[model samples]
Target: MKGVVILGESECSVKDFPDPVPDVGEVRVKMMATGICGSDLHLYHMDKQQAKKRGERIPGHEPCGIVDAVGNGVKKVKEGNRVTIGHWLGCGYCDQCAAGNIMWCEERRGYGGAIDGSHADYVIANERNCVLMPDSMSFIDGAFIACPGGTAYSSMKKLDVRIGDTVAVFGLGPVGLSGVILAKAMGGKVIGVDIIKERTELAKKLGADAVVNAKEDDPVKVIRDFTGGKGTPLAFEASGSAKGRTDIVSSLCRGGKAVFVGAGSSENVINPGQLIGSQLTLMGSFVIPLWMTWEMVDFISTQDITFEGAVTHRFSIDKASEAYRIFDEGKTGKVVFEWS
Candidate 1:
């Protein structure tokens, strides 16, 4: 089997490796589509020590595929069934797992980050992590459900977005756009903000009530002004930038809640006085629970949200490196690795 291996910064190659066999309770999935995520790009240009720590890595996390073979004890899915595996394979027996927060399990392992991910033709997946895909969704679209969809869903649930409430998303990337759709579906008046005009326009198409061009205007003031000077009751900071984090905090009304969803930054400096005085609640969200992921899949099947538009670029497994380059340059929406 052919697979991708990172040689160093800005370097990757197709290396031949032995095809994997499913272990007990595991299933072998024939790769159909895999997404190039933002974190994968960050890991690509790791400064020496970081590179050494993640030496000889295969980078891809948003994977969707069909079951090719099943190991003994696998029964939820059988051969020839299409499915999307959850990115995090958490211990199902842990206390966190009992509370439906499997992503925080002590034995948590991600498909693409900790081990070999789906940047190739085949991947071994635990049967417990698989989510059955609706007949209406394509494999490429299903790829987005694994990570971006799940993460966005988790963030929305964490904030408990109410119907008729107001929301401002501080980025217009794939995850941010997903937030716009989810917020609107929950009956919230959605406002999207981004420096990129193209992304902001896409947010409008996705049902955002207003769009703010961060480069041309002050986002916090503009959002507040648009919201009748009261600011949005809820805000989602989906850009992993210091400026984005600051803007989200400043654009909140008294007692407003903000959720931080994007990754790629290490440190965020925020004001304690403002938080204390405003009585604002700030929450950081990560991966969604398996049950929540299933709910998201059901919503996608019934709602107007479509992952087709979110995926703007496609490449074969061999061009994985080029796909990563395009993602790193921020020139595309969701670049997917399409396997035949």
Candidate 2:
């Protein structure tokens, strides 16, 4: 088997490794597609010695593939089934796990972070982590649903966006762009904010009612103007930057709700006084819970939305290095590795 290994300072390579074998309650999936997430860029830019500490652990969590083999005790999933992995594994008996929010479990283990991930020819996952992919959904769509797309969906759900309500999305990266698409599908008017022109343009193409180039204009002002001076009823923060975080809070109307999903820096960028004054509701959303995976698939299917437009680049595993470099540039949409 071959897997990607990050060598720090924005470098990566594909290397040979022993094929993984599943244990009880596990299944091995032949990789069909995997997405390069914003979190993966953190590993790519690690210092040399720090990156070496990862030591051959593959770096991909967004995975969609076909079940190639199953181990003893695996009953619900069978070989030849197409599935998207849930990425986080938890102690089966924990209350959080029982509620399908495994990411909150005290003993949570994340694929691509704590264990060998899906940027390989084959990956081993717990049978419970495999969500069946419909025949109508492409592997790329399934892969997005595993992470970025799912994250956006969870945030939008938290915001409870409604028809005629304006949504201000503070970032135009993959997750933020997904917010644009999903918010539109849910009947909200979306205003995408980003410093990059290309990203703002992509957001417009993806159905955002308007876009704000933060580098050249004040996003909060633009959002307020667009909303007829009331600001937006909802906002989603996915830039993971201090300015973006701060601006989103200011861009929301009084009593408006906002959800933060992106992660990069730990800066205290919000003003508590503003929240108190406006009586706003702020929430943090991570990836979707295990139970929401099926719901997201159903929503995508029923809404007839396609995530393929957000995928700007695709590469084979052999070109892992090039893929990492391109994604590190931070100017494109989702970058994925696909297998025939």
Best-performing candidate as measured by lDDT: 2
Cα RMSD for candidates in order:
2.0, 0.9
CA error at residue 320 for candidate 1, angstroms = 1.1
**Candidate 2: how many backbone clashes?**
0
- Model 1: CA > 4 A from native: 47-56, 266-268
How displaced is residue 243 in candidate 2, in Å?
1.0
Cα lDDT tens digits, model 2, 1-340, are 9999999988889999998999999999999999999899889999999988889899999989999999999999999999999999999888999999999999999999999998999999999999998888889989989999999999999999898889999889999999999999999999999999989999999999999999999999999999999988999999999999999999999999999987877988889999999999999999999999999998998778878989999999999999988988989999999999
- Residue 30, candidate 2: how far off, in angstroms? 1.0
Tell me the deviation in Å of residue 238 in model 2. Answer: 0.2
TM-score of decoy 2: 0.98
Mark the regions of model 2 whose C-alpha exceeds 4 Å error after superposition: none
lDDT of 2: 0.93
Per-model TM-score, in order, reads: 0.93, 0.98
Instruction: State the lDDT at 229 in candidate 1.
Output: 95
lDDT of 2 at 289: 95
RMSD of 1: 2.0
